[model samples]
Target: MSNSARSLPDVAYVAQPGLSGRLDWVGMDDIQAPVMLVGEDDQPMRFPARVGAFVDLARPDQRGIHMSRLYLHVDQALSTQAVKPALLRTLLDGFLASHRDLSSRALLRIRFDYLVRRRALVSDNAGWKSYPVVLTAKLEGGRFDLELGLEVLYSSTCPASAALARQLIQQRFRADFSTQDLLAREQVAEWLGSEQGICATPHSQRSSAEVKVRLREDVESLPFVDLIDCIESALQTPVQTAVKREDEQAFAGLNGGNLMFCEDAARRMQSALDRDARITDFWLRASHFESLHPHNAVAVASKGVPGGYLGGSTV
Candidate 1:
């Protein structure tokens, strides 16, 4: 095995002696790879996107780290508008093919800011903002795991608690059946200010919608946007990304009528996800940054993972 006859790296980058330490994988995170990822833009978002990649490198006995090859695989897949679970699965398959002797387990993480324009409630003014997002993809034993997460900003209107207070306040008063057997919400609002009502509507700002689903075998598509729409609609007081006065008026009316507590928000979201047929399994978390309290309020529900979905147990 003379020098010319020996194997050499097919890539240009060189790994320094013992530079990778004992870690099985290491590489750039902010390394931007242009992608037209599915479920993102209705049109292709072909700008540079950042991804965190890891390739298995065994003992120091190995000759080279296939870093460039790994990047190339990512680039190639991303070149087409074909980035999703299947694409990632193929990339991992390619990675394993390139490093046959190394371990088969591979991990890929994509972290990027997703921006959408929202309409302001009353002004209908357009505002552009970004949401922090992360996608975790892993391949092992010929199967792949994909997770997509979105943190959404919203406001929760405390309806249940308000109703409770209205009930408590009106229980002892000179209430009559002529009262229409129904107390107008406006009446409840006035009674609280006039009497010993412990009622208050607290708005929780900056809520998050976090969902992860298993893509089923026969399913043709993943309704990521539709799910996002359902989740946002369930929030009732979803903050606007683009708004006109009409949108604002609609939103304000929504706040007035669809008051919800943190618990209510969680249940509403759970119901929305449950109605979605595309998702095989789901996990939901709602983090509400409270305006009235020092600490945030949070509620969580998952299908089959919690006791059951919608804050229930035993399915």
Candidate 2:
């Protein structure tokens, strides 16, 4: 009826029962949406993701931000065409456009599971493994920081346990058979091959490679696959996808050869990260879910510049 032309105010308005002195930043957090996008595997994937966003409401006396508009902007973008990095940027950019007078910055986050088809070690038969990927972006002063994070599952074995098993088997064989009557080495080796207890370690389960990268501001390329591969290769002990008997044997051999404790796995990943020139900084955590113990064993490492270690002083 009036000149405004808009039917009604869309923002979530809460009538303050009692007024406060001031409120700085008040917005929405954990709003969920199913967004369509090309996954890291380069195929169309839809994500039912939760978003956490915040916006600043200006004026020294203002109470809160427009929470409804923020949620609506994210929902609209999520419901649009297949999401790419560029499209996500559009969503963050649009938040500012929708509320021009409210704030200078808008933060957006989307968490989704990325399904990757992996082949079996013995079967070449394909199956899906889900990796959690998070897409995050921030817009302020016409600059955007885009970050993509992914987690890769791998495996490892314990070297100390393997060594102990070998020694124990040899000792048992020697004790059971006389020194003059039987040679322990050949008998122990055969027993080790046959015995289930000595064949593998106590704690051999899946390990994960977690990687996050800040996309180059000028370039549009997000090397998601390459980043994942680099992480897997760094670990050097990924569980096999497709396998024949030979593949299974090879996988077993890899697990045996790369016998590692949690600390060893962490060090290996760290060394690999330090060797790779593509990453700016990296942090790695290697965990071994214990079969014998109730608690898990873990090790962590981070990549830091060697300014002071190379004779320069620390900040």
Candidate 3:
């Protein structure tokens, strides 16, 4: 037999469909890939990201989408280029171009753990802290949108609990010391330095703030570190990774000074987000895993931007 004849195969025996409907989104998820992202220092940082790529199938007669084309385009775009809003726009353009008749919109979401180096409070030591970060981009009807999501962990001391604990400490102090002993400054100082002085301690729990913000058109790069800094500064009690005796003491002092309820945390995050001009809209959820209770305390806040986020979805 001839080589051409042997290589030939049946071309008409492919899967066929009778009818097809328009799909809002058609693509892949949990795609493990290495992507290069621009960091806060304006340097390229590479990370393994879980990516989701989708495009709207507008054509109703199409049997199915070319899934391999979407995957290949994503691989090409993310592997060589640094992640930014502009690059994402180009990627979305490519998605629509590759599927000219079938797709009209494209969306991409990349989730990764970003490592940030944090300095110990009141100590020279530092450690690496990982923040769960997500970047999402969407292109629809010739308009592009970008959003950034991150979670910040901190310590939240209950204000009401703190007051109750303070009252108990005062009662204990009065019971331990007579009226004449209270007048002696040296004796009182010694008593205050002892562990017995603080007989009761306020309840504090590790809390997290999950925030998502839509970026303005003028923003050229992702501001992950800046957002994290703003949240930590507002909360005043970010959890520490590296700790010494002095560092722990300083962290405790910070928590004592910044006692807050879930409502306070949500408002603080909202106020901090409002001052940033680069953020057009935001949704924040502050969750306190209460130590004294079996359930978590959560407060949600969002900027009521018309036609923007409605505080319904975390994505």
Candidate 4:
């Protein structure tokens, strides 16, 4: 076959004229692309990410966006370099440059599961934990903005339930022991070692906190580990990966010490984010998948800055 005969003509994308209407955003989503990112160890790691690429249709007369160009540029950029605010800005520049007169703003969102090895509490072993993460970048009128979003899972023990359980245990102890028996440590320890000591246990539920932060202009690197560390430290009971007997005991102690409701979790996260200089603004939602109730309990908090995140806004 002749080489010229194999050439396919590009028609719809090249010659077709779309309806004359300005679009707020236009481009592709769920595009699978290989991306390089900084890991917890401050080393470059590669992962497959689901990406959404877009640019605003500022010119109504323009036929359509060059979607293939956007895809190609993003694919190339992500494949070759680690994703950062500066690199994302460059990618947006390429997006606008490809569209020329058709677009004035560009945006990109990438979602992936970030894996971090976590050491077990009071144990020598460690295991991998996966965190859902999303990175968003926007470029408009020569200005760029970046946002980072992630979720951390933890255990939330209801304080009210704990207090109620403690009361029940005290009643049981009084009923089981005479006043003289209560004075003997051996008798008291024997009774406490039995299952009757904890006749009623406080209700604990798995909880998650979804957090989004707007990055400051001077932030050069993605602070994934730092942000996760801050959140985990504030919460004080991140879901464990590996569990030994000692680890489980330590985790139980942590749960007992850090009993909280959804509102408490939200406030803790808000305070932690407020102290972070790299974050200009933050939105946090703490959800408790209640074991005692059929529905989940949720609380939301933000930096409360004007024109920042509003209540109940999706990250």
Candidate 2's displacement at residue 263, Å, is 2.9
Selected candidate, larger lDDT, 1 vs 4:
4
How close is every model to the real structure, measured as TM-score? 0.70, 0.77, 0.92, 0.93
lDDT of each: 0.65, 0.67, 0.88, 0.90
lDDT of 3 by residue, 1-315 (tens): 599966876332234447667889989998888889776676788989999989987877666666777888889988999887888888888888988888889999999999888999988999999999999999998888999999999999999999999998899888887555436788778888888988889999999999999999768888888999999999999999899999999999999999999999999999999999999999999999999989999999988698887753542
For model 4 the local lDDT of residue 113 reads 86
Q: Give the poorly placed runs of model 2, Cα more than 4 Å off.
A: 1-25, 39-43, 58-60, 180-192, 196-202, 240-248, 274-278, 305-315
TM-score comparison, 1 vs 3, better candidate:
3
Q: Residue 100 in candidate 2 has what lDDT?
A: 79
Model 1 off-target regions past 4 Å? 1-28, 38-42, 57-64, 116-131, 160-204, 217-222, 244-246, 305-315
TM value for model 2: 0.77
- Model 4 residue 31 distance off true place after TM-score fit, in angstroms: 0.9
Runs of candidate 4 with Cα error greater than 4 angstroms are 1-19, 40-42, 178-182, 311-315
Q: lDDT by residue for model 2 over 1-315, one digit each (tens)?
A: 475736676333434424554344456767878877676556677768777776656543444566777888877777877766677678877788876766777778778776566666556576776778777677888887777777877777777777877777666655655556755587556765676425434357777666555555554555556666677777767766656787778778778778878788777777776675555555556777766677878776666545212221211
* Ranked candidates (lDDT, high to low): 4, 3, 2, 1
Q: Residue 126 of candidate 2: its Cα lDDT? A: 67
Candidate 1: 10-residue stretch with minimal lDDT: 306-315
TM-score winner = 4
Instruction: Supply the global lDDT for candidate 1.
Output: 0.65
